[model samples]
Target: MAEITDDQINTALARGEAVRLAEPRAASVRYDRQLDRVIVDLTNGCTFAFPPRLAQGLEMATADELAQVQMLGTGSGLHWKALDVDLSVPGLLAGLLGTASQMARRAGRITSSAKAAAARANGTKGGRPRRSA
Candidate 1:
């Protein structure tokens, strides 16, 4: 039996292929910028950190919208109506990095316009509501 080299493993990963692992029983996930990695805090109390650039690339949100992203579930996926960005965590984890940033940028414009309208309706000039007397 021969040991697999890192280049081979990375090549398989780059092709959107799956790689078998030892089946981690306990793994918690979170982003860590200081370490520039996605830290998977495990149930065994051990932490595994992955590169942030890779995770960010795989994310379905823009740089700004990514800041506003809210994780909807513990499993996978994120939703940001304000940014109009929705993405599956699994795809990201697998390094898919689909098209969500553009959508979010476009949606951000719409959201801003809507907010402006609401502000206008509320009287942006700060005038008191006129009495119908």
Candidate 2:
């Protein structure tokens, strides 16, 4: 491992501050039981909400568990201590609910006109080709 340097630490901190300033950060957060959603109140006075079921680790969480959310590191993230789950606030805001494979699994169950059209197009090409192996 490389040795740490004061200059490097300062540079990294500066970059983090720049990112925090440029993005909407959580001022407060809560789990709305009635709505079954996690709501985040941003420092910019904007509010955002999403269903807990759509988030990977949160899908099976009880209302009590979902209510255990805490803001992490300058409000750039959210953590559920009991569930051992951590999610990036910016990533969530950008429509990312989980890892690639997790998102793909969820997406596979969704039906859309565009997806149907694409499937038909693929079928016209004899569907997916078989591997040589």
Which candidate gets the maximum lDDT versus the true structure?
2
lDDT of 1 by residue, 12-83 (tens): 886643322322322445544455444455434554554433443434434444345455444345555565
The 10 consecutive residues of candidate 1 with the worst lDDT sum are 17-26
Tens-place lDDT digits, model 2, residues 4-23 = 89999999999988988999
> What does the lDDT read for residue 52 in candidate 1?
35
Error of 2 at 132 (Å): 13
Assess candidate 2 and give its TM-score to the true structure: 0.78
User: Which segments of candidate 1 are over 4 A away from where they belong?
Assistant: 1-64, 99-133
Which one is best on TM-score? 2
Clashing pairs in 1: 37-50
Model 2 alpha-carbon drift over 4 Å, by segment: 1-6, 112-133
lDDT of model number 2? 0.94
> RMSD of candidate 2 to the true fold?
3.6
